[model samples]
Target: MKKNYYYIAILAFVFVFSSCKKMLEEEAENFVSPSQFYKNEAQCVAALNGCHNPLTSIFNQGLILANEGVTDLAFLNNQNNETRFELSPANPGMGKGLWTSAYQGIMYCNAAIQGIKGAPIAENRKPALIAEAVVLRALYYYVLTSTFGDVPFYTDDVANLATLEKVNALGRMSASDTRKFLIAELKAYVDALPKLRTSEVPNNRISSSMANVLIAKLAMWEKDYGTALAALNEVKTIYGALAQYPLEDTYFRNKNKPESIFEVQYTWSVSGLKKTTQVACYFTPPRTANTSTYNGINIPELGDKANPFTSVSPSAYFMSLYHVWDPRRNIILAYTYNGQNFTRPQSGNGTGKPWMGAKFWCPGMDNLADGNNQKVFRYADVLLLMAECANELDDVALAMSSINEVKRRASQASSASINLELTSYPGKVEFFREVREERARELMGEYGRKWDLVRWGIWYESIMNTVANEFVDIKQNVRPYHEYYPIPDNEILRSDGKLHNNAYK
Candidate 1:
């Protein structure tokens, strides 16, 4: 797989400090200190690549369990505590991996930003390079606060053991305040960042488009609709005419296309360097019962004989959201693929079977190693968010246009409608409900379903009302505090009581 060459730069970090703890344990005599390393532009860029490494670690099944598997869009059939709402500070399940990766990413970003600031590079050149690290730090915080809520916040680099100890002893900050700080920080550097599409950038590097989308995302979390809409509008203006970036590019046939705003890049090779994702195994259905040769459901490119692990399945309610006229139905969910039937036993709201469709399926899968980029932000998501903001701001016409554009794209022609107009609904509340459903149709399995529910003040209610059989335990075990996961017990122990767990009642 041909990947952006910057990924290769991450190899350079092997001689540098990998983490704060590693610094404390290992001597700097044999390693390249930050002061010795960040003197040149190439080293600064390499530090940015180091910041990107943790993304792969962060987007695994653990992230899915916390973000999507427990939500209305998908389910984990296993007895994982995250799905069953049985999580504790000690057994945070997937939350442990998420917290670890996010902080790891944050640490790398802080180190890069600190290094770049003192790098003797040209004054004009610093902003763009530093901008990448800044946005990346904000992205990590977005994940941290979105999942854990009110986490220990820091932007300082750990220069030595003392600084590391101070960071370790820091207390939690309010999620809202953290988000506010992130928004302001991102806005400060967004313009300094390059204005390029994912295709134009290497390895889906953070661009101005991604910053704007994230700004909108953070603003929405704060219920600051005006700010969110403004940021999204900036993206629409920059990207221009969404048709140029087709939805088909969203498929893994080729990644980092123009439509992609940001993604976690992956590459797999049997004879060479390989960094892969397990997303395919997480979504693909198991072999059909009473059949041999994997039931002919194999994707030809990936040695069709490989069977999927079926670790996660789409909820019946999520599958049922598709309209008969909706062209996205086939793209997002599958009853059949490549002339082979997809079948599963009765489960999850008793709707039987519908596998996670083409958008996520990996063709060249080996074992659980699939080389597909996990999408973080895309153009369609921006449009849907715009529609949501318009509804909240009472600009019904804008709301209709924003959502209708998404429908038109899905239908592949103009004049397609799904009752998104003001007159089509009784009032703004009904219109807002339609917007929620539209967002689900566009971004169900990608991310942010649980965050959407929580920000809209409906996570607990939505899960309890969902009729999926898989959600039975969740409904019985869920509480209001389940909206945010508990802090990992090890983190609390490490913090010496400065950090605390959620009040999980």
Candidate 2:
């Protein structure tokens, strides 16, 4: 298998698209024009790779911090100034990187789809390649609309100056329209993608199974449980019979594990800033020696001797949810420094938060570029979503069985004390509550909590309660407008008033 070094050039292409107005409009003197570039299969693949580049940026520390920080699981370091509910359109931490990077990636997908159609590639190969680009475009738009509510949505590539002007003058689409378009596109293109990656780099590319998982996710967002269930059942039909796809504890650090349906690939050797993800730098605690003792107990050496900025920490509320025997607590919270474990201090280091877990810590890398592949969709998520869908569909037996699958894995990894049974819960509501809490425990720091809360329509209510009790300083800022992030001020300006802010405020 070849290492994914091809993404290095893709990173450069992302920068080019980020700086230029229309990808086709500004041709560098040394670079071939878009019309002349996609002459063969290799060239078309490169173009598609460029579309995948922005995902690295979208999942990086900046966006993860914003997403997780706003949820109950974690909080940004105090110096960042943007609290859970205190964000604004002009706030520096209000996810501009996510907004811009997602759109840039979408534009690349649009261009790649257009370019591939004109390429001289084999007829058998064109549909798969084009399907790959289309699924990715839907993924990017999913992130955008979920975060900002209504956004400027388009599918056409800006092939010339006039088309670029026309696109720039377009207004934001209704959220309903955006969701409908994405559902239609995914349904259309999913069949063309391969069932699994056949390249030397196995999980680096999209597949039909991954697309189905994404479709399930989008359907769940729209509260369309029937569609979501059908999509997930399709995934089950393909992967459920395979013994390799069972739930496991080691999927976090292990790349392309059977549980992973789709992941953003990252490699240290990819040679550019986008080559690696910065999750370790933001989540790992400072690498101080074990000299300091808390309550006369020695605090173990915290992180590796790397520049882990330690700018994000798990909330006390989040830590309190886990029982001592829960396997995920140790994986999600860094109470132990080095090898020696210690209790969290009551209050000291900038609001006195507990450190993030070893799941994101990279032992050998001591710099910003830690090569951790971010999991976008995984099998455990599919199980959990199935549980939720089954519960909503009034199938208590299926819901309990699905939720127990995840719990069974957790219990095997830890102790029997953490094990759950269908009899443990009193009723359906309690079972559903456990399911939600289980998601928090299992998927913390993976950037799913805020969206989960938002889709449940409890984001504002839950954050308001958390702020009023644990963080009174930010309590007053909690409002309905905080549900969806404000559209970036720059995007609004670029649209020349065609784009408007989210309507909550």
Candidate 3:
């Protein structure tokens, strides 16, 4: 994987992207100031690519922790403060890293959008490039608002130190207003974006499909089902039938496949440029630190030698949701590796737990430089979201049809699985409950579980329903305010008394 790095000279937005290909590789090529850059199409493209850097930075751990680590579907075995519900406004744990990373990406997007608009590029090329930056900006905001209830919001690039300080000192915006603003912002550029999948794009970059996915997601937060369904319809048209793309091919086994709407690109290399992630380390089975052996037994499925973080793994409650005949049962959970049985935690403790299935396994991923591209948005998630919207809008038939597509694929038509027939649950409330559980069974270990429950106004109560003894601390310490992590305390200090911390129990 050969990569070239171009240097863009914005003080706040100094990151590297490939000069030849689509990968966001970081290196120094030339040091051109903001005033002299974005003079051509290539320069404009480089600016847009830089916006992707912050997303890669956060993907390693911040994203996994904030989105999945604390949710009921996954468990962080190391007693992480966030996963244990022990974090606070002062000691925010993963929230601090997420806050810094998301804001940095937003700054890059803000600068790139302003730069691309003024660049002397071809007129026809400007919209797509600017739209990429626009969507990227919205994505960063989405991360911030979803994680923390409210945050300081800005779309324009900072001019100087004085302007930067002013922006930093701004107060928080309401999450509702912020999401509404981002939804309208995306609509302005959705048509300008090409209606294609990320795999069809050169670097698996943002497409019109991705923009619509984000719009639908933000709209779901607002409880606007009509807007969400309309956006998802556009995605359905672009991605085509869901049956053609299988779960095995679309996830960890490959990168940038047909169903990939957006993936954080990663590469592992002993020499040259290496962009990789630690995401796989979390979900992999618990092992001795820096070794693949557990209890002095080597698991070949976890690679010959690797560094496993012993972090997140499937919860007992989550594993209980899958039917025995479901093909996805094995794909999503690893019961045995290489003919050896995995064990549950002895009694109540969470040790010797099973790995998070083949989808997250990275063989020989020593030192946590796993080359697997993290799936951010995919076709399966879009289908489930469509079903949720349809059910909410009183179109039970459309809802059933949409969800059944994913269920049919998981079931593999192996038997007359009663659970596979989502249409059987004709009542709206009953059907919606099925949709929620189906989301857990299908999208588990992926992002947005806590958000899914929160948007439905059930985050606090849902986690409370867990009977798993390993998560006793989570149920004991969780509160209504825990639905949204508090804004990192340092951010409040940086805001010059303008930003306030979220309330605690």
| lDDT tens digits by residue: candidate 2, 293-329 | 4323443432234566645656666877787777677
Q: Model 3, residue 408: displacement in angstroms? A: 0.8
Instruction: Give the root-mean-square deviation of each candidate in angstroms.
Output: 6.4, 6.6, 4.9
* Per-residue C-alpha lDDT of model 1 across residues 309-388, encoded as one tens digit per residue: 74666777777788755756666777666656655433455356676777777776667778887777888889889988
Task: List TM-score per model, in order.
Answer: 0.88, 0.85, 0.90
Mind sharing the TM-score for model 1?
0.88
| Ranking, lDDT, top scorer first | 3, 1, 2
lDDT of 3 at 70: 62
lDDT of 3 by residue, 1-505 (tens): 0011112223445434333234554232343466677778877777777777777776666667667766767767566776777878887877788888788778778877888888887888888888999899898888788888788888868646555656765899888999999999899999998788877876677789999999999999999999999999999998877888877775564888999888877877667557777877776766765556753447655565566676576666787788867767666777665556666533246444556777777766766778888877889899999999998998877898899999878766454455575647568888888888898888775677888888888887767776235667776777778888887777777676798863762
| Candidate 2 local lDDT, residue 163 | 61
Q: In terms of TM-score, which candidate is strongest?
A: 3
Q: How well does model 1 score by local distance difference test?
A: 0.74
Model 2 Cα shift for residue 289 (angstroms): 6.0
